[model samples]
Target: MNQPGEDFYCDEALSGRTPVTVVAETADVLAFEHTRPFWPVHVVVVPKRHVPSLTDLGEADEALLGRVLAVVRQVAADVEREHGACRVLTNLGRYQDSKHLHFHVCSGAPRHPDTD
Candidate 1:
């Protein structure tokens, strides 16, 4: 059964929405676009399992956690190549909305003077 914040990443899924780039995926994760991105190359890294919070992770989740980071690195590298450069970040406590453990990979700023 899904937990309270497990559906944090589900907003886009449930809404049947799509983002600009869905770079990669694994057995336990999905990488997609950030709806309200803070950077030029913004992507969201989500786990396939509906895990409600990073603080709530258990023994079984340890491996999944590691895999998430691994994917983040790979994706970040790709983002740099494709978009030049980017940032990888994760929110905690009040910073997180979905309560689900996710990573935000971004490249460049929301408004770069060079772009404008």
Candidate 2:
């Protein structure tokens, strides 16, 4: 279970409130290890500049979205290379605990087998 703080990805990871193990990053995007990984291999990707959610994207967000997707593609490729399969996901609405726009790249077994 990834016990993310009350802060969203922006306030936690981007603003440096929470230290993160960075996987990849560009001036406008970042991919880092999940704070508390649910899966054996879990990583989080987000735009350095805050975008609220997927539905909130605009034409001005295209460039940043491209950069974020590029990073997600690379990370997913790496995960699938080792695990044989990987899942990329983005949650919206009530499912989204954090309001920040982000992607999840994950694979393998659960980190904590005890949890459902």
Candidate 3:
């Protein structure tokens, strides 16, 4: 679990600020749709607490981590049902921007042909 002194993004996605539709949520995790989707269907799953990064997760957060993964699986199943297929993604260190641990569930192919 995250405590004070940690700096991370708020649960803004839960409010549907992003392109997410909020599939489910728990004490520690949240699942939602992606606004500018990488694929036809894109969703982002995140931990509610403010963990600076995946590398910053503490011992007490082990269960929370497990729950996050479980939600990923459940959300992935839901995404597949809705979009036919899906991809699970997580970033580390420099690749992460929000500074909070989150997973992106992507489905279908890139919308723009110019994208690589």
Candidate 4:
């Protein structure tokens, strides 16, 4: 079973079918508030173009990868500046429920919501 907001970014956000609380965006990257945030300051950063995982990045994706990381860096800075500290991470292999390449920028305590 697909957990409520699991893979929500690919299933909805990227498709533009579901409105997201966007925090930042560039031509190739998007950083937005998690639809169902598990952490107090959870934000998702992704490339507008689908790339499966960080390990899957190829030479052809060099420019796109740079753009994605740039957005990730900025989002993390903003979060840390306000929240004191932040964690920037990406899930891989079995830990990655969503196949799309994305970075999680989070801080503070988790909200502990039932939906997540």
Candidate 5:
């Protein structure tokens, strides 16, 4: 179960409290399979360091964000190649569940009705 206010990527995934199947990794970024997937094929890419949200970036975060996106691009490309189609997205403000900057690379129909 997830808490109401928590940075799942930083507190669980990046901290290694929750083991994840990594798809790609870098010094500043990590991409892995979603623990609880909302789609048939779902991958999550995030900065290893906590950055509250996309709009919360600072000047120093630009490079890290680029690295994160590079990983997202690779993961999305792989998913698209394997599944024929893919979607890359990120939630912000009220739409974000976890308070961490992350992007979803997914393919195929959503597995859950509540997927956003």
Candidate 6:
């Protein structure tokens, strides 16, 4: 039950309101299976803290971003290894449903038609 235009990661997942099946986790990042997956093998990597968007990062967020990307890399590698191929992506601006900086590591065809 995520609200539109809200930061699902910070407001739900990070806050422990929404339970997530963790794929990988680090000191500053969390990679988990998407609550509502768009692809067959879909995982999301996000920073523990609330960063508005990828483009909104400041100097203080560099280390955190690096950690987040590192987790994303590992998760993407795991998905690609098991699924043969995978896509790693992040949305920005109006394309982003949630105002949290998160990356999708996914493989296979879209589960929902509207996702494509």
TM-score of each: 0.75, 0.86, 0.75, 0.86, 0.89, 0.89
Candidate 3, residues 1-116: lDDT per residue as tens digits? Answer: 43432323364554444444667888888887765667777778888765556677744377788899999999999888988888898888768766678888888877884763
Counted clashes in each candidate structure: 2, 0, 3, 0, 0, 0
Relative to the true structure, how large is the alpha-carbon lDDT of every model? 0.74, 0.84, 0.73, 0.85, 0.86, 0.87
**Cα-based RMSD of candidate 1:** 4.0
Candidate 3 stretches with Cα past 4 Å from truth are 1-8, 14-20, 58-60, 113-116
Give the per-residue lDDT of model 1 (tens digit) for 15-108.
3554435678888778888766667678898777666567776334688888888889889999889888788887777777776778888888
* Residue clash pairs of candidate 2: none
Report the C-alpha lDDT of model 5 over 1-116, residue by residue, as the tens digit.
33544788878999899999999998988999999998889899998887888998743367788888888888988888899999999999889999889999988877866555
TM-score of 6: 0.89
Error of 2 at 8 (Å): 1.7
Candidate 1, superposed: residue stretches over 4 Å from native: 1-6, 14-21, 58-60, 111-116
Q: Once model 6 is optimally superposed onto the true structure by TM-score, how far is the C-alpha of residue 64 displaced, in angstroms?
A: 1.2
TM-score of 5: 0.89
List runs of model 2 lying over 4 Å from the truth.
1-7, 58-60, 111-116
lDDT of 2 at 86: 98
Q: Best to worst by lDDT, what's the order? A: 6, 5, 4, 2, 1, 3
- Which residue runs does candidate 4 get wrong by more than 4 Å? 1-7, 58-60, 114-116
lDDT by residue for model 2 (1-116), tens: 12455337866788888899999988888999998888889999998876767888633367788889999999999999988999999999888888778899999866765765
**Model 1, total clashes:** 2
State how far residue 68 of model 5 sits from its true place (Å): 0.8
